[model samples]
Target: MNWYVVYTKPKWEKKVAERLNAIGVVAYCPLITKESQWSDRKKMVQVPLFNSYVFVQIEEKERNRIFEVVGAVRYLFWLGKPALVKDSEIEAIRSWLSVPETYEVAAEQWKKGDKIVLESGPFSSQSAVIQEVKKNHYVLILESLGCVLKVNKKEI
Candidate 1:
Protein backbone atom coordinates (compact mmCIF):
# COMPACT_ATOMS: atom_id res chain seq x y z
CA MET A 1 0.00 0.00 0.00
CA ASN A 2 1.06 3.60 -0.71
CA TRP A 3 0.18 6.77 1.17
CA TYR A 4 -1.04 9.82 -0.75
CA VAL A 5 -1.93 13.25 0.54
CA VAL A 6 -5.40 14.57 -0.29
CA TYR A 7 -6.27 18.26 -0.35
CA THR A 8 -9.72 19.08 0.97
CA LYS A 9 -11.81 22.15 0.19
CA PRO A 10 -11.79 24.60 3.11
CA LYS A 11 -13.09 22.69 6.17
CA TRP A 12 -14.28 19.84 3.97
CA GLU A 13 -11.66 17.44 5.23
CA LYS A 14 -14.09 15.21 7.14
CA LYS A 15 -16.61 15.46 4.33
CA VAL A 16 -14.02 14.49 1.71
CA ALA A 17 -12.90 11.54 3.80
CA GLU A 18 -16.43 10.25 4.32
CA ARG A 19 -17.24 10.57 0.62
CA LEU A 20 -13.94 8.93 -0.33
CA ASN A 21 -14.46 5.98 2.01
CA ALA A 22 -17.99 5.46 0.72
CA ILE A 23 -16.60 5.09 -2.80
CA GLY A 24 -14.27 2.25 -1.65
CA VAL A 25 -11.16 4.40 -1.40
CA VAL A 26 -8.93 3.58 1.57
CA ALA A 27 -8.08 6.79 3.44
CA TYR A 28 -6.37 7.08 6.80
CA CYS A 29 -7.13 10.19 8.82
CA PRO A 30 -5.16 10.14 12.01
CA LEU A 31 -7.48 11.25 14.82
CA ILE A 32 -6.24 12.93 17.99
CA THR A 33 -8.57 13.80 20.87
CA LYS A 34 -8.13 17.34 22.16
CA GLU A 35 -9.71 19.78 24.57
CA SER A 36 -11.07 22.85 22.81
CA GLN A 37 -12.25 25.89 24.71
CA TRP A 38 -14.84 28.38 23.51
CA SER A 39 -16.01 31.55 25.27
CA ASP A 40 -18.68 29.75 27.25
CA ARG A 41 -17.38 26.22 27.69
CA LYS A 42 -14.70 23.64 26.95
CA LYS A 43 -15.34 20.54 24.87
CA MET A 44 -13.40 17.71 23.28
CA VAL A 45 -13.09 16.89 19.63
CA GLN A 46 -11.16 14.34 17.64
CA VAL A 47 -9.26 16.48 15.15
CA PRO A 48 -7.17 15.49 12.19
CA LEU A 49 -3.49 15.17 13.01
CA PHE A 50 -2.84 17.07 9.78
CA ASN A 51 -5.35 19.73 8.85
CA SER A 52 -6.96 19.82 5.38
CA TYR A 53 -5.09 16.70 4.28
CA VAL A 54 -5.40 12.94 4.87
CA PHE A 55 -3.20 10.00 3.97
CA VAL A 56 -4.54 7.33 1.68
CA GLN A 57 -3.26 3.78 1.39
CA ILE A 58 -4.01 2.41 -2.01
CA GLU A 59 -2.45 0.84 -5.08
CA GLU A 60 -0.53 3.25 -7.31
CA LYS A 61 -2.42 2.36 -10.47
CA GLU A 62 -5.85 3.33 -9.11
CA ARG A 63 -5.33 7.09 -9.38
CA ASN A 64 -8.79 8.04 -10.59
CA ARG A 65 -10.42 6.64 -7.44
CA ILE A 66 -9.06 9.62 -5.50
CA PHE A 67 -10.53 12.44 -7.65
CA GLU A 68 -13.88 10.66 -7.65
CA VAL A 69 -14.60 11.77 -4.06
CA VAL A 70 -16.47 15.03 -3.48
CA GLY A 71 -14.61 17.85 -1.67
CA ALA A 72 -11.36 16.12 -2.59
CA VAL A 73 -9.97 18.89 -4.72
CA ARG A 74 -6.73 17.17 -5.64
CA TYR A 75 -3.78 15.13 -4.43
CA LEU A 76 -1.16 17.20 -2.62
CA PHE A 77 1.90 17.01 -4.85
CA TRP A 78 3.81 18.97 -7.44
CA LEU A 79 3.27 18.42 -11.17
CA GLY A 80 0.03 16.44 -10.86
CA LYS A 81 1.46 13.35 -9.16
CA PRO A 82 0.56 11.68 -5.87
CA ALA A 83 2.91 11.99 -2.93
CA LEU A 84 3.88 9.04 -0.76
CA VAL A 85 4.15 9.21 3.03
CA LYS A 86 7.19 7.25 4.25
CA ASP A 87 6.47 3.89 5.86
CA SER A 88 8.52 4.84 8.90
CA GLU A 89 6.53 8.07 9.39
CA ILE A 90 3.21 6.20 9.20
CA GLU A 91 4.55 3.59 11.65
CA ALA A 92 5.43 6.40 14.06
CA ILE A 93 1.91 7.76 13.66
CA ARG A 94 0.43 4.33 14.41
CA SER A 95 2.57 4.08 17.54
CA TRP A 96 1.18 7.44 18.68
CA LEU A 97 -2.42 6.42 17.94
CA SER A 98 -2.10 3.32 20.15
CA VAL A 99 -1.96 5.59 23.19
CA PRO A 100 -5.20 6.86 24.80
CA GLU A 101 -3.89 10.42 25.11
CA THR A 102 -1.06 12.42 23.57
CA TYR A 103 1.20 15.26 24.63
CA GLU A 104 3.64 17.62 22.99
CA VAL A 105 6.84 17.87 25.01
CA ALA A 106 9.63 20.38 24.87
CA ALA A 107 13.19 19.48 23.86
CA GLU A 108 14.45 19.60 27.46
CA GLN A 109 11.71 17.26 28.75
CA TRP A 110 13.00 14.86 31.40
CA LYS A 111 12.70 11.17 30.62
CA LYS A 112 13.84 9.54 33.84
CA GLY A 113 12.15 10.89 36.95
CA ASP A 114 12.73 9.30 40.34
CA LYS A 115 9.56 10.40 42.09
CA ILE A 116 7.95 9.05 45.24
CA VAL A 117 4.37 7.90 44.83
CA LEU A 118 2.24 10.43 46.76
CA GLU A 119 -1.18 8.90 46.45
CA SER A 120 -2.82 6.99 49.31
CA GLY A 121 -3.53 4.04 47.05
CA PRO A 122 -2.05 0.54 47.23
CA PHE A 123 1.25 1.59 45.70
CA SER A 124 1.62 4.72 47.79
CA SER A 125 4.85 3.46 49.40
CA GLN A 126 6.47 2.63 46.10
CA SER A 127 9.11 4.73 44.38
CA ALA A 128 8.36 4.97 40.69
CA VAL A 129 9.98 6.05 37.45
CA ILE A 130 8.20 8.08 34.82
CA GLN A 131 7.36 5.83 31.88
CA GLU A 132 5.93 8.56 29.63
CA VAL A 133 4.44 12.04 29.83
CA LYS A 134 0.85 12.08 28.69
CA LYS A 135 -1.61 14.99 28.66
CA ASN A 136 -3.59 14.10 31.80
CA HIS A 137 -1.20 11.62 33.46
CA TYR A 138 2.34 10.43 33.80
CA VAL A 139 2.82 6.72 33.30
CA LEU A 140 4.83 5.38 36.22
CA ILE A 141 6.52 2.06 36.83
CA LEU A 142 6.36 1.31 40.50
CA GLU A 143 9.27 -0.75 41.81
CA SER A 144 7.37 -2.35 44.68
CA LEU A 145 4.15 -2.93 42.78
CA GLY A 146 5.99 -4.35 39.75
CA CYS A 147 3.31 -2.78 37.58
CA VAL A 148 2.66 0.34 35.54
CA LEU A 149 0.48 3.11 36.92
CA LYS A 150 -1.05 6.13 35.26
CA VAL A 151 -1.64 8.90 37.78
CA ASN A 152 -2.52 12.50 37.17
CA LYS A 153 0.59 14.46 37.97
CA LYS A 154 -1.37 17.65 38.43
CA GLU A 155 -3.69 16.09 40.98
CA ILE A 156 -0.81 14.54 42.86
Candidate 2:
Protein backbone atom coordinates (compact mmCIF):
# COMPACT_ATOMS: atom_id res chain seq x y z
CA MET A 1 0.00 0.00 0.00
CA ASN A 2 1.12 3.51 -0.72
CA TRP A 3 0.01 6.95 0.41
CA TYR A 4 -1.75 9.05 -2.17
CA VAL A 5 -2.71 12.72 -2.14
CA VAL A 6 -6.42 13.50 -2.60
CA TYR A 7 -7.85 16.84 -3.55
CA THR A 8 -11.05 17.68 -1.74
CA LYS A 9 -13.77 20.26 -2.09
CA PRO A 10 -13.06 23.60 -0.48
CA LYS A 11 -13.25 23.46 3.35
CA TRP A 12 -13.93 19.69 3.21
CA GLU A 13 -10.58 18.34 4.32
CA LYS A 14 -11.59 17.26 7.81
CA LYS A 15 -14.98 15.92 6.81
CA VAL A 16 -13.55 13.94 3.92
CA ALA A 17 -10.91 12.43 6.15
CA GLU A 18 -13.55 11.38 8.65
CA ARG A 19 -15.76 9.87 5.97
CA LEU A 20 -12.87 7.97 4.43
CA ASN A 21 -11.94 6.54 7.79
CA ALA A 22 -15.49 5.38 8.34
CA ILE A 23 -15.28 3.53 5.06
CA GLY A 24 -12.12 1.68 6.15
CA VAL A 25 -9.64 3.91 4.43
CA VAL A 26 -6.70 5.30 6.35
CA ALA A 27 -7.00 9.04 5.90
CA TYR A 28 -4.98 11.91 7.29
CA CYS A 29 -5.97 15.55 7.45
CA PRO A 30 -3.42 17.61 9.28
CA LEU A 31 -4.91 20.38 11.38
CA ILE A 32 -3.61 23.33 13.37
CA THR A 33 -5.22 25.29 16.12
CA LYS A 34 -5.55 28.97 15.42
CA GLU A 35 -7.10 31.88 17.16
CA SER A 36 -10.06 33.24 15.24
CA GLN A 37 -11.40 36.65 16.12
CA TRP A 38 -14.93 37.81 15.54
CA SER A 39 -16.58 41.10 16.28
CA ASP A 40 -18.14 39.65 19.37
CA ARG A 41 -15.47 37.29 20.61
CA LYS A 42 -12.33 35.33 19.91
CA LYS A 43 -12.08 31.56 19.84
CA MET A 44 -9.56 28.87 19.16
CA VAL A 45 -10.46 26.66 16.22
CA GLN A 46 -8.89 23.75 14.46
CA VAL A 47 -8.19 24.42 10.82
CA PRO A 48 -6.76 22.11 8.19
CA LEU A 49 -3.05 22.74 7.77
CA PHE A 50 -3.29 22.29 4.03
CA ASN A 51 -6.48 23.53 2.50
CA SER A 52 -8.39 21.16 0.21
CA TYR A 53 -6.03 18.25 0.56
CA VAL A 54 -6.11 14.91 2.33
CA PHE A 55 -3.83 11.88 2.38
CA VAL A 56 -4.98 8.31 2.06
CA GLN A 57 -3.12 5.05 2.36
CA ILE A 58 -4.32 2.15 0.25
CA GLU A 59 -3.21 -0.48 -2.19
CA GLU A 60 -3.14 0.29 -5.90
CA LYS A 61 -6.26 -1.78 -6.50
CA GLU A 62 -8.11 0.10 -3.75
CA ARG A 63 -7.45 3.55 -5.09
CA ASN A 64 -10.86 3.86 -6.64
CA ARG A 65 -12.54 3.17 -3.34
CA ILE A 66 -11.74 6.69 -2.13
CA PHE A 67 -14.37 8.10 -4.45
CA GLU A 68 -17.06 6.44 -2.39
CA VAL A 69 -16.60 9.25 0.11
CA VAL A 70 -18.17 12.54 -0.77
CA GLY A 71 -16.00 15.63 -1.25
CA ALA A 72 -13.11 13.62 -2.63
CA VAL A 73 -12.63 15.22 -6.01
CA ARG A 74 -9.59 13.35 -7.36
CA TYR A 75 -6.06 12.28 -6.71
CA LEU A 76 -3.46 14.98 -7.03
CA PHE A 77 -1.37 14.38 -10.12
CA TRP A 78 2.21 15.36 -10.83
CA LEU A 79 4.16 14.67 -14.00
CA GLY A 80 1.13 12.83 -15.45
CA LYS A 81 1.08 10.42 -12.53
CA PRO A 82 -0.72 10.29 -9.21
CA ALA A 83 1.27 12.19 -6.58
CA LEU A 84 2.60 9.90 -3.88
CA VAL A 85 3.50 10.89 -0.29
CA LYS A 86 6.18 8.86 1.38
CA ASP A 87 5.44 7.30 4.74
CA SER A 88 8.53 8.92 6.16
CA GLU A 89 7.28 12.34 5.16
CA ILE A 90 3.97 11.63 6.82
CA GLU A 91 5.76 10.56 9.96
CA ALA A 92 7.84 13.69 9.88
CA ILE A 93 4.75 15.85 9.83
CA ARG A 94 3.26 13.91 12.71
CA SER A 95 6.38 14.28 14.78
CA TRP A 96 6.80 17.96 14.00
CA LEU A 97 3.25 18.80 14.97
CA SER A 98 3.47 16.89 18.21
CA VAL A 99 6.07 19.30 19.53
CA PRO A 100 5.01 22.86 20.23
CA GLU A 101 7.81 25.36 19.80
CA THR A 102 8.53 28.81 18.57
CA TYR A 103 10.97 29.29 15.70
CA GLU A 104 13.03 32.38 14.95
CA VAL A 105 13.16 33.00 11.23
CA ALA A 106 15.82 35.19 9.74
CA ALA A 107 14.43 37.01 6.76
CA GLU A 108 16.66 38.35 4.04
CA GLN A 109 16.54 42.03 3.25
CA TRP A 110 14.18 42.30 0.31
CA LYS A 111 12.92 45.35 -1.44
CA LYS A 112 9.74 45.90 -3.39
CA GLY A 113 9.81 44.49 -6.92
CA ASP A 114 12.47 41.97 -6.06
CA LYS A 115 11.72 38.53 -7.45
CA ILE A 116 12.43 35.59 -5.20
CA VAL A 117 11.85 31.87 -5.09
CA LEU A 118 10.40 30.25 -2.02
CA GLU A 119 12.64 27.53 -0.63
CA SER A 120 10.07 25.71 1.48
CA GLY A 121 6.55 25.63 2.82
CA PRO A 122 3.45 25.00 0.71
CA PHE A 123 4.75 27.20 -2.10
CA SER A 124 8.17 25.61 -2.19
CA SER A 125 10.29 26.46 -5.22
CA GLN A 126 7.67 28.83 -6.60
CA SER A 127 8.82 32.15 -7.91
CA ALA A 128 7.10 35.22 -6.51
CA VAL A 129 7.35 38.94 -7.00
CA ILE A 130 7.51 41.17 -3.97
CA GLN A 131 4.61 43.53 -4.33
CA GLU A 132 4.77 45.33 -1.02
CA VAL A 133 7.03 45.19 1.98
CA LYS A 134 5.68 46.12 5.39
CA LYS A 135 7.25 46.21 8.81
CA ASN A 136 5.71 42.86 9.78
CA HIS A 137 5.14 41.09 6.50
CA TYR A 138 5.74 40.96 2.79
CA VAL A 139 3.06 40.83 0.12
CA LEU A 140 4.08 38.47 -2.64
CA ILE A 141 2.39 37.72 -5.92
CA LEU A 142 2.75 34.19 -7.22
CA GLU A 143 2.11 34.30 -10.96
CA SER A 144 1.97 30.58 -11.53
CA LEU A 145 -0.54 30.05 -8.71
CA GLY A 146 -2.35 33.28 -9.50
CA CYS A 147 -2.46 34.20 -5.84
CA VAL A 148 -1.21 36.96 -3.61
CA LEU A 149 0.45 35.85 -0.42
CA LYS A 150 0.96 37.93 2.70
CA VAL A 151 3.71 36.17 4.58
CA ASN A 152 4.72 37.17 8.07
CA LYS A 153 8.30 38.22 8.68
CA LYS A 154 8.65 35.52 11.31
CA GLU A 155 7.59 32.90 8.80
CA ILE A 156 9.98 33.98 6.06
Candidate 3:
Protein backbone atom coordinates (compact mmCIF):
# COMPACT_ATOMS: atom_id res chain seq x y z
CA MET A 1 0.00 0.00 0.00
CA ASN A 2 1.09 3.55 -0.72
CA TRP A 3 0.17 6.84 0.83
CA TYR A 4 -1.56 9.35 -1.42
CA VAL A 5 -2.60 12.94 -0.87
CA VAL A 6 -6.33 13.63 -0.86
CA TYR A 7 -7.82 16.99 -1.65
CA THR A 8 -10.80 17.93 0.48
CA LYS A 9 -13.41 20.63 0.67
CA PRO A 10 -12.42 23.84 2.35
CA LYS A 11 -12.15 23.49 6.14
CA TRP A 12 -13.00 19.82 5.91
CA GLU A 13 -9.66 18.13 6.30
CA LYS A 14 -10.32 16.82 9.80
CA LYS A 15 -13.84 15.66 9.04
CA VAL A 16 -12.75 13.84 5.92
CA ALA A 17 -9.96 12.12 7.76
CA GLU A 18 -12.31 10.99 10.47
CA ARG A 19 -14.81 9.68 7.98
CA LEU A 20 -12.13 7.82 6.11
CA ASN A 21 -10.95 6.18 9.29
CA ALA A 22 -14.48 5.15 10.20
CA ILE A 23 -14.60 3.24 6.94
CA GLY A 24 -11.37 1.37 7.83
CA VAL A 25 -9.07 3.50 5.76
CA VAL A 26 -5.97 4.88 7.43
CA ALA A 27 -6.06 8.67 7.29
CA TYR A 28 -3.76 11.29 8.67
CA CYS A 29 -4.53 14.94 9.04
CA PRO A 30 -1.77 16.82 10.72
CA LEU A 31 -2.90 19.62 12.98
CA ILE A 32 -1.22 22.50 14.80
CA THR A 33 -2.47 24.61 17.62
CA LYS A 34 -2.44 28.34 16.96
CA GLU A 35 -3.40 31.23 19.14
CA SER A 36 -6.42 33.02 17.70
CA GLN A 37 -7.52 36.38 18.96
CA TRP A 38 -11.14 37.43 19.06
CA SER A 39 -12.60 40.77 20.06
CA ASP A 40 -13.09 39.58 23.60
CA ARG A 41 -10.19 37.24 24.26
CA LYS A 42 -7.60 34.92 22.83
CA LYS A 43 -7.84 31.14 22.52
CA MET A 44 -5.70 28.30 21.30
CA VAL A 45 -7.33 26.33 18.52
CA GLN A 46 -6.20 23.30 16.57
CA VAL A 47 -6.13 23.80 12.84
CA PRO A 48 -5.15 21.47 10.03
CA LEU A 49 -1.51 21.98 9.18
CA PHE A 50 -2.27 21.65 5.48
CA ASN A 51 -5.56 23.19 4.57
CA SER A 52 -7.89 21.04 2.43
CA TYR A 53 -5.43 18.17 2.30
CA VAL A 54 -5.35 14.81 4.04
CA PHE A 55 -3.19 11.76 3.56
CA VAL A 56 -4.63 8.30 3.07
CA GLN A 57 -2.82 5.00 2.93
CA ILE A 58 -4.42 2.56 0.53
CA GLU A 59 -3.69 0.22 -2.30
CA GLU A 60 -3.78 1.59 -5.84
CA LYS A 61 -6.70 -0.63 -6.82
CA GLU A 62 -8.72 0.73 -3.88
CA ARG A 63 -8.07 4.36 -4.66
CA ASN A 64 -11.63 5.00 -5.73
CA ARG A 65 -12.91 3.92 -2.32
CA ILE A 66 -11.84 7.26 -0.84
CA PHE A 67 -14.59 9.07 -2.71
CA GLU A 68 -17.14 7.28 -0.54
CA VAL A 69 -16.34 9.76 2.19
CA VAL A 70 -17.96 13.14 1.98
CA GLY A 71 -15.70 16.16 1.45
CA ALA A 72 -13.00 14.02 -0.12
CA VAL A 73 -12.76 15.68 -3.52
CA ARG A 74 -9.92 13.96 -5.37
CA TYR A 75 -6.37 12.76 -5.20
CA LEU A 76 -3.61 15.28 -5.67
CA PHE A 77 -1.94 14.84 -9.02
CA TRP A 78 1.70 15.50 -9.77
CA LEU A 79 3.29 15.01 -13.20
CA GLY A 80 -0.04 13.80 -14.56
CA LYS A 81 -0.36 11.00 -11.98
CA PRO A 82 -1.60 10.67 -8.42
CA ALA A 83 0.92 12.13 -6.01
CA LEU A 84 2.44 9.47 -3.78
CA VAL A 85 3.77 10.41 -0.37
CA LYS A 86 6.85 8.51 0.58
CA ASP A 87 6.79 6.54 3.82
CA SER A 88 9.88 8.34 5.06
CA GLU A 89 8.23 11.68 4.49
CA ILE A 90 5.18 10.55 6.44
CA GLU A 91 7.37 9.36 9.29
CA ALA A 92 9.20 12.66 9.28
CA ILE A 93 5.98 14.53 9.77
CA ARG A 94 4.97 12.22 12.60
CA SER A 95 8.32 12.60 14.34
CA TRP A 96 8.38 16.34 13.86
CA LEU A 97 4.95 16.72 15.36
CA SER A 98 5.66 14.32 18.24
CA VAL A 99 8.71 16.21 19.46
CA PRO A 100 8.34 18.80 22.21
CA GLU A 101 7.70 22.33 21.05
CA THR A 102 10.54 23.88 23.04
CA TYR A 103 13.26 24.96 20.61
CA GLU A 104 16.35 26.95 21.46
CA VAL A 105 18.32 28.36 18.54
CA ALA A 106 21.49 30.29 19.22
CA ALA A 107 20.98 33.87 18.11
CA GLU A 108 23.22 34.71 15.22
CA GLN A 109 23.57 38.04 13.46
CA TRP A 110 22.14 37.65 9.96
CA LYS A 111 22.37 40.20 7.19
CA LYS A 112 20.74 40.51 3.81
CA GLY A 113 21.98 38.24 0.99
CA ASP A 114 23.32 35.72 3.45
CA LYS A 115 22.86 32.12 2.40
CA ILE A 116 21.83 29.82 5.23
CA VAL A 117 20.43 26.35 5.65
CA LEU A 118 17.46 25.81 7.91
CA GLU A 119 18.31 23.53 10.84
CA SER A 120 14.78 22.88 11.99
CA GLY A 121 11.06 23.16 11.21
CA PRO A 122 9.20 22.07 8.10
CA PHE A 123 11.89 23.14 5.61
CA SER A 124 14.73 21.67 7.59
CA SER A 125 18.03 21.26 5.73
CA GLN A 126 16.85 23.48 2.88
CA SER A 127 18.99 26.47 1.94
CA ALA A 128 17.47 29.91 1.80
CA VAL A 129 18.76 33.36 1.00
CA ILE A 130 18.01 36.25 3.26
CA GLN A 131 16.00 38.76 1.27
CA GLU A 132 15.28 41.28 4.00
CA VAL A 133 16.27 41.52 7.64
CA LYS A 134 13.85 43.30 9.95
CA LYS A 135 13.95 43.90 13.67
CA ASN A 136 11.35 41.25 14.47
CA HIS A 137 11.69 38.88 11.53
CA TYR A 138 13.60 38.00 8.39
CA VAL A 139 12.24 37.45 4.91
CA LEU A 140 13.94 34.56 3.17
CA ILE A 141 13.69 33.29 -0.37
CA LEU A 142 13.59 29.50 -0.70
CA GLU A 143 14.63 28.86 -4.27
CA SER A 144 13.79 25.17 -4.12
CA LEU A 145 10.32 25.80 -2.79
CA GLY A 146 9.94 28.91 -4.93
CA CYS A 147 8.37 30.86 -2.09
CA VAL A 148 9.31 33.72 0.19
CA LEU A 149 9.11 32.83 3.87
CA LYS A 150 8.98 35.23 6.76
CA VAL A 151 10.75 33.75 9.78
CA ASN A 152 10.31 35.43 13.13
CA LYS A 153 13.29 35.95 15.41
CA LYS A 154 11.80 33.79 18.14
CA GLU A 155 11.37 30.88 15.74
CA ILE A 156 14.92 30.95 14.37
Model 2 agreement with the true structure over 1-156: per-residue lDDT tens digits = 799999999999999999999999999999899999999999999999899999999999999999999999999999999999999779867865775444333456988999999865656567999999899888999998688988778753
Residue-level lDDT of model 1, residues 21-122, one tens digit each, is 888887777777889999999999888878899777778889668888877777888676668787766766776577545233222243557565433443
Per-candidate TM-score against the hidden true structure: 0.59, 0.66, 0.72
Clashes of each: 0, 0, 0
Q: Which segments of model 3 are wrong by more than 4 Å?
A: 36-42, 88-104, 154-156
Whole-model alpha-carbon lDDT for candidate 2 = 0.88
Tens digit per residue, CA lDDT, model 3, 50-149: 9999999999999999999999999999999999999988987887787666554333588999999988776678899999988877889999868898
**Residue 145's lDDT in candidate 3:** 67
Q: Which candidate, 1 or 2, has the higher TM-score?
A: 2
What is candidate 1's TM-score against the reference?
A: 0.59
RMSD of each: 10.1, 6.1, 3.4
* Residue 45, candidate 2: C-alpha displacement in angstroms: 0.4
